[model samples]
Target: MTTSTAACAFERKDWLDDYAALKTALEQRYANLAWFASPQGGVDLPALDKRTRRLLETAEDESMAKAALSAFVSGFHDGHFSTAGAVLQPKIAQPLALPKVDYSRLNATQACAALGYGPARGAAFSLPFESLPGTVLEADGLTRAFRSGVVAAPDGTRFGVVRIARFRQQDASPAACEQAWSERQAKGAMSEADVKPVKQAANAAWLRTLAAQLQHFREQKVAAVVVDVGNNPGGNDTGDWAVRLFTAHDVHSARMMMSAAPLAALYFDEQLDGLRQAQKEQDPTPEAQAMLEQSIAAFEARKAGIAARGCDLSWAWSEQRPWQPNGCSRLIDAGYASGQSSYLPPKAFGNLKIASSIYWAAEVDDLRGAWNGPVYVLTDGGTGSSAEMFSALMQDAAGARIVGRTSAGDGCGFMADAPPVVLPHSRLRYRVPNCVRLRADGNDEVAGVKPDLPVLPTEGENDRERAWRLLDTVAADLRARGAKP
Candidate 1:
């Protein structure tokens, strides 16, 4: 990336040799190099790669070497780290709302509508439901009903509600797979190469419409079950049965791991060839043929542990004392490697796809116990990635109760299928986070889901009166823990 006679563009020493080949491809395929060597992962990465090589040695051109390659991937303050081609992932210009305009004549996605990026994804967070208190049984509540709605409480307790707005197509899609993904993106194909059987038939049609809306809120006996994912913005965290279909039991997921390199085993061998092209586009269901032969034997044991420790590794990212790979470490396959986690069972719980891509849904193990009662997710800060993986799996495997705030810190993304690091002289494109997940306090759901009850939203409050005053303070903390409401 460093040759220049100025034939075409990217001059400044070809953007500092594509920012030292994206800092040696994120220090040999990044997966949070032992959380940038811990101390609760403060992140130094060799002093942010020596201050982004002295900000790309005072680049004398190409927008300061693309702002020192986005300030060295925003100093790895990660969220699946970033970068992109043509234009996106380089916005930064927010603080200015009140009668504030002309942000240097706005452009970084309108100079920031709450932190913009690829379609400036921060705004839109509504589903009003005309001031709550019953009757919102769906009819376009965020596009024909995955917005179910309800709230009550004041000594009576009711609750129910729904609204996820995303886990990739938050529910109603199937128009012949959205016209075959708009005719394969008008021929520029690979919308994630047939997006996992078109999102395993839109997650088996939103787990049979969220198992008949959690069996119609346990026959309308609702006393708990909020799950809003407010301002959602994330999608298909392997679309895990959107937090194991609203709990009746068995939730336990997020262990996941990867990064042994060789481009993370060819990005999970292109996610095991898109699960062998969605098992040849149909014909799997002996429970989707044993969960697509156990995710093609955990993508062939994560491509033979990245080809028996596939070389090219690096660490000492200014060590605070963590880097632990005794040869391309970070695993998770010894058949769902227990004791230190790595799971997915209950018919590969949470949409690993069974009942083969919804032939009109239902019967994916009758969509799991379908609501065994008191659940509560909420969340905000525009929640993110698999909606913070269903708010950290409804606060650690469905005991639910998360309330609001502290999400959007983008917990775990890019699970399988990779191929977008490109940079050689401004071809741009970038990527990071080879895969992590964790979260059972062992941390690393990209450090996000934090609400045991944070709430926040008073000044001019409104998303339906701050989501019915945070689900009536979660029904007064479930009636001060007596909970039998």
Candidate 2:
């Protein structure tokens, strides 16, 4: 079909039909749809639909149609629920240009303060600083220096600090690096291989910088180490490296929920079976054999109950499992035990079976780490996704005090991996989250993580200055208790 014809073909009737189909599919297959649709709180689907229909009717062009769809999906209030395509990519904002700051004007004392150090004896701040006189201290300069560095407190006592702005995997393998290079080349973003480093340096720098700072803190016997993720926008979940600097005990952070109970049950079955087989091959001890048997029996019983409810497990065998769990968790309590009903009925004979074989629970763990120190995490409304995950871990696991405002609450709990749905006419794409993240308390929305010691920036104070003030406040309190080194 011609472009103009295709665009004209997407009439009100066509859009209405498509909307109905998409809504039905989400209700039937999307795991966290019910949670987002719950009466307690969730997107008002009817209202959203009304708004969407109105936008569609008045839309003057293809771009308008796409914008309407984008607005409609954003109503779900999930960061992970987003679109991606050639058309959508341009709409995404790129990183801001760093502002140039004249650090030459500031004297040594002002420079130290700018770097987050106080003038009092034994007073330390966790700001990123290189050499005192030579450092540029501009926006980008500070960012690079703060990625990892060490500086002296007023009393000549050295302190360490590492700024992790995101949680992406640093030091990707050679193959992955090459693939990224190729993609960049294809986009005409980069031309020469030599122009890029031999390896991907973004995440590697973050990891190495953090490790170096931690090592400096350990060697210098700094009073305490500060991990700054105040402006973090969140990324991967592999940020446990920072936590391991202080402790090694497993810390339970958050629980995860699958799209459906049948999918979770099938996963449990596979895990249990793998354990049973491994034990059999190892010629298990009596205790091991007994444990394996008990686990298998339990799994079998659960499967039998699901079967009795007329649920089908055949769908689990598909190569592309529509609903894949993103993170891991230990089963704390079953859905039935908590008197929680299944989000949806199980599949039976290619239809939804009217039974409660679906299992769910409240308690689950997300980011596990061993950090047992006097940790203080700085957060702001921008903290989201894996960044929020890190904040939750610091509070729930290490008992770290969170200072600053509440987090952005991006709902990494319900992460979505589904491919965007492209509109044939407008070429607009829409996406939805597939998984649901729940805290131990059974809540997963964008309400954000609250700070223990709430501190907001003053009239002219930036986040860094506010953070420095809070650190000084914390240090003062600790000193009063004779806790300073």
Candidate 3:
């Protein structure tokens, strides 16, 4: 691929004198990044050194380089910071085309299908579909099948659903978006009181509405429950609420274990894997040999520590797994248990807010047994983080069949704070990822759970239509079993 010439030319200029204050402010902003020390409670000197050199060399005018490097280092899939400083990338200037319909506001799959989609088929007890590579679906042309529930079914077995496509707005400035979000929050798009501390009562209210719909299916003796999370960009408590609606009241919380030790496990694994791949090449460097030794030493130390704690070490034996170096990545260390849980506790002790704020109890007694029939969940690339966590828990605990497209496997749970870090010479600004997100199963190291049934929508199947198809399939299954529509 051809490299960027605009970036190279800009790097040649003496931008220091021309943009001194902006450079200074940028440097100051990223300084706090140093705080992200390695497992031994010290920053990896080599890594930091390399990163600093990269920043300085590209700081002059290579905006693309900066963005690429940031993304490379952070490991976050779509972190906005990585896109910063791009000088020559084409700006988005095309005339915008708003979605013809607001699928998000539609509560049922029948309504979504009316908008122009196919029959509903869920992850379980349903047929598969296809994908559309270069198509933009218009929302205004479809039928409307909505009534009172967030999700609906056209038949006893088929499941129909509705969800958000993606959040896209023309001319959406950061300030403007924040303002709009604030206004929406004020208007109760989520809850009445503060959205933070994730209100259980308010969350329950929303969930009860969904559960009531499910109850309708139950009353009709429907075979399955069609759930559409497509439009779900994911709210804090929304996924949690879903779990409560489907599972049993006697649910047990899965143990969650998190520490900096897994970092060594991941690092050594990557190094070993890279060497194994490079072993097929011509000559391996002497530096690579030394790196191998260091990685082995670190791996041994981490293994000993983790093993003493009775954690599983089988992951250490896996060979040559490709590694993604973005900072958001994780590797699961073995450990799993089954039981009942209404709330998740802190992995360690520091996260009091998370441990206490989340309430898992709800009106539905048990999701696994509540329906007394088949259960289905719809997912796609957008299902991530807590949503992924909720899905995994359901699959593991309640045996819910996951349908639609594969979920976004970006399930790291730790929150990233943007505190400022100061650099040594430039007095520059930077931020580093702190804290680890532990899964319900206790290991803080795994990517999001993959779907059991991976079904992609057809090329012409819009998201709304996909949900409806799933619902119809589920409804048909229910009717076949002598259930009412």
Candidate that scores best on TM-score: 2
- Give lDDT tens digits, candidate 3, residues 59-174: 75545434434433454332122332223334579958775544234323322233332421222212222122221221111121112222345542333232322211111112
TM-score of each: 0.32, 0.58, 0.45
How does model 1 score by TM-score?
0.32
Error of 1 at 281 (Å): 50
After superposing candidate 2 on the true structure, give the runs of residues whose Cα lies further than 4 Å from its correct spot: 1-10, 38-46, 87-146, 150-159, 171-221, 231-245, 248-250, 261-371, 413-418, 421-427, 457-459, 476-485
Across residues 220-253, which tens digit of lDDT does each residue of candidate 1 receive?
Answer: 7878777676787676643455555676676656
Where model 3 places Cα greater than 4 Å from the true spot, the runs are 1-60, 71-200, 258-372, 415-446, 457-485
Determine which window of 10 residues in candidate 2 has minimal summed lDDT.
359-368
TM-score of 3: 0.45
Off by over 4 Å in 1: 1-11, 32-63, 66-68, 71-157, 160-222, 227-248, 261-371, 374-376, 379-387, 390-409, 413-434, 438-461, 465-485
What is the lDDT for 338 in model 1?
22
Cα lDDT of candidate 1 equals 0.60
Question: What is candidate 2's local distance difference test score?
Answer: 0.48
Which candidate, 2 or 3, would have the higher lDDT against the true structure?
2
Best-to-worst order by lDDT is 1, 2, 3
